[model samples]
Target: MTDATLSRADPIHYQDATTLAALIRKKEVSSREVVQAHLDRIAAVNPKINAVVTLMAEDALRAADAADKAVAQGAVLGPLHGVPFSIKDALDTAGVPTQRGSKLFAGRIPTADATAVARFKAAGGIALMKSNLPEFSAWTETDNLVTGRTNNPWNLDRTPGGSSGGESAAIAAGMSPIGIGSDVAISVRGPAAFTGIAALKATQGRVPFTGHYPAVTKRWWHVGAMARSVGDVALGYSILKGPDGIDGYAVHPREADAGADHIPGRLRIGWVAEAAFGPVDPEIAAAVASAAARLADLGHDVEPVDLPFLGNPLGALMTLVFGEIVPTIKALAAGREGDLHAIGAGIVATPDPTFAAYLEAEAQGEALRSAFAGFFERYDVLLTPVNPMTATPHGAQELVVDGKTVPWTHVMAATSPFNLTGLPALSVPYAFSSEHLPIGIQLVGKWLDEATLLRLGAMLDRKGGLDERRPAL
Candidate 1:
């Protein structure tokens, strides 16, 4: 690429994947130019943010060239043709190191791409790099023995939330236009909120978890999309959604419709600032209320929702997840426990769950889902805070919310319920805190109704006024 080409494509790195694809298809910019621009941006900014752990510069450029050739030949293009996207290191990418931020899997490369990665590639997107994550992708913050920590591009001293932290940081920093991240509870949404990006954790089965780490039978786990814009999240989710023949749990009962015309003129939106979601920070609560008011002004039926049964499920989630964690660590470590990361060590030290407790947690999950089902029957969407607070300082194990100190894990309060209920949820930056950190609001939709979340998210994305600001990186 020439200096002129690099200069021209520089701003393209920040454009959403959907726009990039359209530009490529129209021959306004070459795929190589797009890929190289991102590679350059990653090289320039990643050391400061440390989001990308393994970059596939050569392979990506080669793929970009092939995409340009296809366009030159006038071949029909996929919706994401010529786009560059990152993958959370937790997801497998064939022939590329798929280390899930643990030394145990360091340098390990898979022979086949994770279904999500394969779908992106199949749609003509380039695998730009592998983003960082907590070891085994089990922590709420992105730090690991394998690749160290991924800092928030917005504030280097703070974390970018995990286990999708790196993916969000990369997108927020304009290193990659879009990427895929796994979410058992809050991985995708938490990171997106922390980094001022947009992400969607579709209903659990909407996307297959076939090649993600911690290959467990946890029904609450999900694989989803993280992008700088809701439009990109919508596009990426559409490509990643549908069942892969291998993952029996992955099935889409209905196709997604993100078209503006498909959305109703008015939606019944129920919002909750606190109560069931634990003690939310005042700023976060205000952001949720602001989003609700914006929707109300747009002629939607907006009301504060109170559901006693919809309590924070993070405790139950821990009971189920930690119960599996001990065994999963032992099996994956395979007598190499001494070499496991600190998080893995901590997990192993935690007491195993009794059969009764595990069963009770399962029942709690079932009840949570049942409650959400009934609530959705009354409301088209539920609005809440994505986290109790904005991004926290690196290594912070506790957080103070509304004058009370709570364990850092409480950040998952608003997010884990939807995971347990298997509902689609969107996280989009709504406002900034006094500290200038981005605060996000969560939009939860009925199961298999990501289209609704995406549609409403588009509305919020436009009015949130966050699109005008990029991290001062």
Candidate 2:
């Protein structure tokens, strides 16, 4: 195809993997051509966005060639065959720099791919690059000493959201069709919400965490997909779900497909209008109310729900995340502290603990999990603002929402409880703020009930047509 034809007619850059696969099957486009279009787009757009920090240009081309050859032989193609995708730098990719957005592991390369990455390759997805993340995958904003910060494509002055912020920005800017991102708290959903993309934080352990840096053994971590649409998230999840022998936490016996059938008509949705732990920005609260109104307009039953156990769970979660850093901090700092990140360096510099604090965190987490179970018994799904405000300016550490200064962790308060509960949650774009910044409302479901949440998200997507609205980059 000529460059003009590729630029104008190529569906690969903007289309989801499922749509691209069908086009490939019809010979409307070749896998090699489609992959090349994405590579060209990446080369063109990535410098401004700083989304894909590590490029696999040659490897991506080789894989695309292989995919084209398979098609030429009439070979079976997976759902994501020849589709270009990116992974958060926190996930391992064999022979690639999988630096977890830290200077400490500046040149660290992995010998094997993370289980989720392996699954994507097995499903015929091509890895175009590795996206950016927070240092050690610890923070919500995607900035570090290694590769600098990833800017939001919508407005470069604002952040994309993190630690999966890079992936969300890349997908939103059409840098890649879909990308893999992990959610410790709101990493995936928050970024997706901010960038006007789609993301799913699967029930914990649904996708393996093996080969992830700063290895998460405590405070349940989940690997999920960031994409432009709900259907794409479902397609990616289907490919990445299942056991890999290496990750003990990888789900065994397989998870039943949780796509969209679980959504019911006249659904009862519990709406939390305010931040459970802190005050929400008025615009964000209005966005949530607008989404709830949309659901009500569709005849879904929407009612206010109060979560009294929020503060304790968040406090316990912080203790858990910060407590894990103590060891890493000591090791890195060698008992000397400078900044908080340096204190983190000291924790890493310290010796490994024989009796770790993870156990205590786990114990507290169990109580919080029980509280969420009781809460879910009364609500089919919970709707809350994904972030208290719209996208914050890049380099913003503390935000003043309603005249109260709040730390970045508060951004995850409305979303993280579900992570601790091992429940499924999705961030769906609700409406744009008066500033034209995107605002999203999260739909959270009971444990292992992602299908219900996704169905509701799809219903919202259809009703609101949010996907069609894009920031003019």
Candidate 3:
């Protein structure tokens, strides 16, 4: 499609956070006015996209008034003061329903905010709404009995990607300035890529996951920011990072240098063209390759690298995820047969696995982690496809990758391994496919070294100029 067509089809939503904050700081716009603008935008576009499942209009107006008060009093303002943001429905918001896209807990509301939500509020962010997610945040497509499905803002027939799909869809449609999304796997990255937005999955534990449903008992789960710009992600991360007294898994003696920013220079970037893992969708691969070439043009040294360990990253991830699931199911089910979600019911109906089999899967995961560690030794950043394909149509619970009728879990293969290894990764829009859907490229970085990745991503963001293209909604 022509640039003009894409522009008219899906308009970019939300101004840059920095710019918006500055306007608030300057009194050019009242905090209430800013919040209302977003609220109105959501009302205008959300019905077409269905990304936002819950609105907090009253709470947001109150917070906006407080933000305006702080500015009037000359009170020290947080970096995100008066900025409007959103969270995936899976993240808890006190008093606001967090259905988690599951009928299991349709009206559930938390008594407290998720760690990331608290941080965002503490930074003076106004939480306007909650975005959609897959049922129990387990699927790649955002659909559940509670909130229904979220359509791609660019095209109603296509998906927005999930379990963070709602956030991606909302951001892409200009409903929210920035959003909070969790990544146990590709939930954040995949959706961001599919929707052509920017997202970062900080090294696991960088952001506390406490208070999120499906309680992030696994240390590999991550909470990060999603936005239209890298700088906004950085600003959101700055506010959201650090320890909450409640989460023992939260990173301590934080090694991240908060003030440091990535400076461009000659750097080593590992480009994974192919591996035994499977074939990448040709269009997706081309987008990644094009991104690599753009990085090379920006003076970085890019080379193709081998990632043999990822041959069965999905298998390892399934073992790890299902290992956690078995117990969660038992607890959520509470011995009540047929009470569980359909997918959960299917999972439990299968006969219990032999202990030997469980042990073998765990062993395989450990081995895969070891290989990723070795791979990182030779590469500062690893660039690959976020998903083997672009966003699939809404309601597709399963995807066919490389002729294998894989479960939704395969969508997270490229991402979950990094989560397992505790590495940082970012998903940036690369190019559009033959069908005109956005394709995303993944950039994985060393553990806790998001600065380098963000810097490289910023350069790519500048060079690829995907930001210049907006979807018509």
Candidate 4:
């Protein structure tokens, strides 16, 4: 890499994928140059956070050269032509190792690219690296026997938020501008929020789950696009949203809502900061409430409302996800228990969840879904903090927030409900904690209404509060 490219002063390292693609298309920056710049970035930073586990350096460079030739020859190019993107390790990449954070599958390779990955490549985005995740993509921190641990770039001692932690860390650190992450509970949005970036988990089935592991999470599972801007995320989602005909979860086609952000009048924004997600940090709560106030000041009607069904949204989600996943994963790990991650092994060894418990959880989930649907009837969107606190320490058992020791998944309180209800939710970076950590707010919209969530997210994006901050590392 050239000295110019290696310098942190090179703004290309921090530019969004859309901007990078535009730059390449305009011939101001060659595709090879863009890819190499990111390679240099990863080489310099990956050692610190271990965000990217597998680097496709040679293939990415070759692809970038072909992209440049296509551009030079005046060939029609896709929207993301020549842009570099990171893939979460759980997703399959043909000819690439996709260990999914387990030693049992250490040398495993895929015969085909995951649907989302193929769609990204078809759109001219190069998959430059595979980001790490917890074993089986099941935890709140990114660490496993395969890739060690992925630390938060902001503070090396803190976590980057998980399952999608490595993806978010890479994006936040500018190793890659956009990536894909799966969220069954709080994986994608929580990590995005924790890392101070933009991310959206569209309604269940909006994106396919065909090429990823832990297929059992399919009931409420979704693979979402994580990017630096709401539009970039919307753009990623636009390309990957249609049914791939493989993942049964991907049934409905998203409607064209290109104009979702062009609001003709003030929006009705309902917000809840305390009751549903208990005892949130004052700073976190203040950040979200302030965002609501900002929108209200901009002519929208922002009010505090209580949705009773959210009383135990996380509890309901846990019951449903664990109930369904325990059996499926247990069966998959039948003979390979010793090689699995500790959490995975423990899950498999645990007693099977009862059918009655599954039924009851499903019933509670339906009621919550119906209640959220009614809540949306009275509001255009709902707003709240993405987590009760900022990122926690690696392997943290609990969090001391507001003078109380809370479970690490307190971050899921605001995000998991949307996963359970299959409603669209977007996480936008709005503020920084006193320690200079990122704090994000969640914008929840009606079912399959990612367009509206993006609309609200765009409004927040314009503020660019988090853009001014970057990891010191």
Candidate 5:
């Protein structure tokens, strides 16, 4: 759906949040119509993808009625006045079940919303439902004891990359316009790349993490926005940004660039074809190199630059995540350890984290952060592949790359570095494989500099927003 025709009937199913809001404000469509369109889309597509697990139909419809009334009364509206949105199950939503894809919290509900969700509600967005994620949001596949597994809309035989896999699939399937997602390693970017959409991992603390499940484990985790366009990402970011006062890291308020729509300068972009973390598929590498060439065509300075400390980010990430997470699992599990997911159970089963080991990982992480910050001194942005290859088959830990098997952790290599460094990164769709799966290039910017990433992302998005073809559900 193009921006020019957003008010049309059938294609409103694929429009972005900003356009939907405009349609609502102009009375081209009522909020109830917009919300019901998405709910109907969910009913049609969700069974195949299993992305949206729990439906808040009655509550969402009630909210949509209120939004429509506000529009009719000419009440001042927030940017997202009446658009439909989804929340990841990992985030707390008031009166909404946040099962976290595990039996341990099967009927869990939060009395208060996560800061992100609260802000979305305040913006006049309708919360339609909760999307699926990995149990405790721990691994890279959206399967647990609860919602089963979420498959890629592009190919049901393949997995939709997780831990925000369900959100990506739901968005790709046109079930929701924008949703909240968290990333510790590659959760947001990997799934966005695999599903052919947009997702942001802003600098550490750029978006508050308060009220998110696994609330505070490892400093690398972040909560950010996912949508069909970079403009929508910026819109969501504008509404969700700033310190919630509770998360020590989210210390700043909204920025001037939150309203800025264009790239300010010809950015000097650093491009890395491959890093030390893993081998890349020839197709994926070619796609990223093409993106760099495209930027050069646009008259930007695009050149290759070596990155610092790309070795074994999975090792560093796991070291820090388990070190921080194991203690919490032990405390929460008590005698019900068996109820936890295998990944969670294993963390509890491991020997207690040593202070010396945690200290060592912290030191390494700090150095990595400094290295990325220093690299940004030479270039305004860095570009790399969001993943080495396309989505893998369900339950397959090893990917058959170039006729050789590689560990599943390779999917996260390019993206995990930004998590450690706290630099902002965004996944933008670029190309497709011979088999018709999606490929994406990532743009990394300086700390708290999400504006530049969104700007470049908008440029890339204009070429193709969702895809040349939508998923045939």
Candidate 6:
């Protein structure tokens, strides 16, 4: 749907948040109508995909009415104005059940919104629902004792990917135009790849992790925007970023380029396929090549570049993440062990983390970050596959890449390095697999250089025509 004909009845829920906000500002469509359309879409599709675990139908509608009233009264309006967005259950929503896809927090509700959620609300975006996730948003597929499982919108027999799986599924299926998702390693980018959407894990601390469940393990954690289009992700990021005063780690060393919308004339683009991560699916590798060729076609200097620590950082990343996460899980599950799912139970059962190991992992992480800092000194953007493969079958424990089986955990190979370095990474769909599953390419940028990443993402998105195709749900 083009902006020229946004007023037409063409399923307003499928429109990007930017367009919806513009339509609301122009009064071409009432906020109630827009919110109602998404609510209706959720009702119709949520049952099949199981993405939205909590529905805010009445509250969203009420918020929409207030937004419409603001428009009528000519009150100063925020950029979002009347758009509705989904939230990953990992984030808090006041008076709304967050649950974290765990039985322990099944009915838990926070009195205050997460910093990211508050920013969205302040920007005029209404909270539509809390999307599903694996227990404690830990696993790579969305399923838990409380919320069951979330299926891919394109194929119900497959997973939508996690821990941001539900948000990706909801946006890809048009249930919500945009939403927030957290990434420790691959939560945002991996799921966005699995579900064929656009997401950005901005430089760590760009978006505060305050108010998110299991918050202690945040050294490598990041909250980011997920949408079906790069523009919407960019819009959401603009509002979601900056320090909220409550999260000490969050800071705005420098603002993203005001001219991020305009890509600088030509860029030094570097892409890596299997070299960065071993054994990528043939089709996914081709997608990376296609995107590189397209970038070259766009008059940018494109080449294949490799970093020594690319595929080797996952061990250290996991070490640091699990070192903190295991204790947090054990503390959170003290009296609730019986309620824990298999994954959570297993996590809690792991041997106690060692301080020596923790320090070693931290050192490894610092070295990885140094490597990336050095690499970025010569390149503006680094491209790679978001995952070695596309969306896998539900509850998949292994994946076949290049006709060889590898543990599904290999899925993080292409993504974990960025988290270790706290560099900004963007996941944007570039093509579809032979079976028609969506394929996404990752774009990594220098620290606090999300502007360059998003700018290049816009060009790739435009040339790739991501909006030209949608999941045939």
Question: Which has the greatest lDDT?
Answer: 6
Per-residue lDDT of model 5, residues 1-473, tens digit only:
43534644447678888888988998988889988889899989898999988898998899999999999999999988888899999999988888988788899988999999999999989898899998899889898878888999999998888999999999888999999999999998999989988899988888899999796573789998998777888888888888888999888666734324334567889888655434788888777778888888888999977765555566777788887787887887888878877766766788865888777777877888777767877788888889888888888878876666888877888898788777789998777888888888899988778888888888886353235588878
The candidate, 4 or 6, that scores higher on TM-score is 6
- Candidate 4 C-alpha lDDT tens digits along 305-392: 8777676778788877787778887777888888888878867876766788778778888998889878877788899888889988
Instruction: Look at candidate 5 and tell me the lDDT of residue 423.
Output: 79
Single out the weakest 10-residue window by summed lDDT for candidate 3.
Answer: 1-10
Worst 10 residues of 1 by lDDT: 1-10
Per-residue lDDT of model 6, residues 308-412, tens digit only: 765468888888888888988998899889999888998899876689988988888888888887887777889999999888998788788898889978999
Q: 302 in model 3: Cα distance from truth in Å? A: 1.5
lDDT of each: 0.86, 0.77, 0.77, 0.85, 0.83, 0.87
264-315 per-residue lDDT for model 1 (tens digits): 6688889997776768888888888899999999889999988799654888
* Positional deviation of residue 48's Cα in model 4 after best superposition, in angstroms: 0.7
Better candidate by lDDT, 3 or 6: 6
Task: Pick the winner on lDDT between candidates 1 and 4.
Answer: 1
Ranking by lDDT: 6, 1, 4, 5, 2, 3
**What is candidate 1's TM-score against the reference?**
0.95
Candidate 1 overall lDDT versus native: 0.86
TM-score of candidate 6 on Cα atoms, chains taken together: 0.96
Candidate 5 has a TM-score of: 0.95
Off by over 4 Å in 4: 1-10, 256-263, 462-464
Q: Judged by lDDT relative to the true structure, which candidate is superior, 4 or 6?
A: 6
In terms of TM-score, which candidate is stronger, 1 or 3? 1
What lDDT would candidate 6 get against the real structure?
0.87
- Please give the lDDT score at residue 423 for candidate 4: 87
